[model samples]
Target: MRFFDRTCLSSLLGASLVAGSLAATPVLARQPDGPVDLTAQAQPAKPAPTKPAPATPAPKPSTPAPSAAAPSPLAVPSTSATPVVEEPDTLPVAHWTLADAQSLLATIRGIGAEGLFARDYEPANLAAAIKVGEGDALDQLASRLFVWLAEDLRDGRTPMTARVQWFAVDPDQDNHPNAQLLAQATETHDIKGVLAGLSPKHPDYALLKDMLSKTKDPKQIAMIRANMDRWRWLGQDLGLQYLIINVPEQELRLTVNNQIIRTYRAIVGKPGRTATPQLAEQVRNVVFNPTWTVPQSIVVGEGLGARLIGNPRQAAREGYVATKNADGTITVVQQPGENNALGRVKLDMPNEHAIYIHDTPSRQLFAQPQRALSHGCIRAERATELAMTMAILGADLPPETAVEYNLSGKYTKVPMTKPWAVYITYFTVARDVNGVMRSFADLYGRDPAVIASFAKPRELHTSQRKSNEAVIKLDNPL
Candidate 1:
């Protein structure tokens, strides 16, 4: 089976606005009190500018005899001079003593406690690297382990292993300079503490770690491991406010300040070729009562074109408009209505896959326990509510306006006043509504790839891992 990646399509489709032939200026959601005028205010207007009165001339001073009682200006403290106060060093530093190295080595040996394989950190080799009285080797070992610890903490096994189309954003892209970590390790002499500092502090990460500690079933443990690693695939920070869709669970959540404010049931792409890919995009706007431009694959593959040609009356009855091209091909479009595939509203987030979050007439599908039943695009259960929420949160629209405005039969677009980040991801395990950790079905079969990646042997020592890091490329001197 072939997979259609949408990361590239996002760039191409993003260049053009989704207005179609509609006006560039979308009708703004009406404010209850109408537009504000900067001219009017409760405070009185400023007084008119007045010319200053002519300045009085100063009388010349007469020379006076020196008086011993008069104080000199030099006797006062100099205001221009700034006192330098030495600041105490507050930064954590590493103290790479034999004891410190052994402490870190203990954590490395117990890596399995963190839902990771202990073998991945090379126990035997690390044991050999941290010899007592070998100061140079101990220091080198500390640096190497620090680099490995940082990579595992920041990115989790390589991205390619998970087959995710991820791009570094925000905190993920922020460089974690090894030199700084190494220098701090040298000063603080707390190798274990320094390594712990590198781990992600997100609550979900902590929850998974807690779950890992108690989980005994190998299958469940593996699932948790996969999910934990998936978090590392995403950037360290998910932004102040963003939307995340879990394809496997068929759910969408609007998170603000790390709290989930709203959760909506979603219909994700079907398994196999139509599976939704893991990616990151930004929701730019909402299209109300949008027209569906049927893809040619659907037209020809589904025999829609031939059916329309055989019975022209069906086109009008189904709200389909067929346009014959110069090349003799026909293009079919479904008008906005209750029967429209994209229901009454659609969230606009351009991507190579031509996927978006939108309303769907097939609301009954949401009632099913398993909701993997879409053709790439996500069909939201509470599309109108989600749209209205987005309008108030990102489009600067009043709640009343978002709720009261009627779509009727028009194709209206509401551009976001401020775009919201949206991430499409896949995970086999996560916390449910009741906060109970649960495992989900691998609808797209992504778990195996992630699980396999974790199975790959890690670089034995920190120096080898750092030297082979993709973030650090050594160019040919030629």
Candidate 2:
């Protein structure tokens, strides 16, 4: 009996050891610690969750939140009056005829209802897209299809986005998603199309969906659409693996395999300034104990700008100090540590704007419903693992050692063993989800330019995009 017990114990111990070993591997996913994943990432101090917001009181209609400007109600086009062109005779298609394609947009424009760009013409475009059999025309149709589906939720006539104004109108149903669009998406197998209609559960999903939907140039859309693809293709394209921060919708999705596996809230450069320029770049290295170099603009323009003069020591006390140059232009940088503005780690992605992804000590900001607040660089919630993930996705370096290197205060490149494809893109729409359309703030007002860029009576084409032709890789590669 003792011998039997010993053998059983040994078998259990062996099984436990195997499980532990598997958990240690990066391939295995551990439960997210409700914050950053330190076991597989870095030594990130978890931000405590804030108190639940007070139940939204019955809101006043004319009054917008004093913190920001209130946007007007979205104008949903009246499609109830219009009739769907019954094409019951036609089979679901992979392409659209040029006539069908032209008619999609042409008829809408001819109707003089510009507001119907996303909804009124979408079905037509989808039908037209299916009619196109070959070349870039098909690709253009796909892009348009992506854009329309994505935008309707965010920027188009479809109510894909959450409207704060709705609270004043329909308090009960405002928070409860009106599954008006979602029901339609459920009928399709197009994951991208459905995702394009994502709701408040993921607001940026709608914006990116729309951004993809409005593309006239297939080449551009195809590059950015990989993030929305139903397939996973990573490491096949070895190019500059830079950081991408899309500011308009406040969410940050880190991409590898041309897919977004990591996403979080980012506090971009305040819309009040051109400080955090909308752009993309390669992260040269990370600085653990980073020093914040205050820009001349902040010192010269802010109300407390001259505070560094009489009480320079006060600045240092708050983990900030002024770096005086011979030219008399002083730069204020925050010190690294608990008090540091950039919490612990900063992913250094190079671009025209000295903007990079960084951890913020102000975890309270994450709780805010509309988190479009930031000085310049992106203040990423759950940034520690994101930075660590960036290093691991492209480079083989252990996250611990990377943090140590940053703590050393020495700037160094987290080498990329495999290329990380980071695409910094903006679109008002997408089609990744259940047919719900999503929309967002036209942060740069790039919509008009985007609309103008649509192909001018261009022929429908579908040349296979070389960038998208890469072989799909498996998470557990065989």
lDDT (Cα atoms) of all candidates against the true structure: 0.59, 0.40
What are the runs in model 1 whose C-alpha is more than 4 Å off? Answer: 1-103, 132-135, 162-190, 301-317, 404-408, 459-478
Per-residue lDDT of candidate 2, residues 40-71 (tens digit) = 22122322211212222211212211111122
Question: What is the C-alpha local distance difference test score of candidate 2?
Answer: 0.40
**TM-scores, one per candidate:** 0.69, 0.44
In terms of lDDT, the best-performing candidate is: 1
Over 1-478, each residue of candidate 1 has an lDDT whose tens digit, in order, gives: 0111233222212322222221222222322111122112212332221222222221111211111122212132322232232212222224477677777668766666555554444445456656445565455545555555655766575334245433323244245665676676657776667667666655777877876666555555566777887777677777777888887777787776676655777888777556676667888887877888887777787888878865668897988988778998888888888888788888998765567888887788888777777767788877876776677667877544554443346787889988698888876676554344556677776676566545443422112111111221111000
Compare the candidates by TM-score and give the number of the best one: 1
Candidate 2 accuracy as TM-score: 0.44
- Give the Å shift of residue 435 in candidate 2: 11
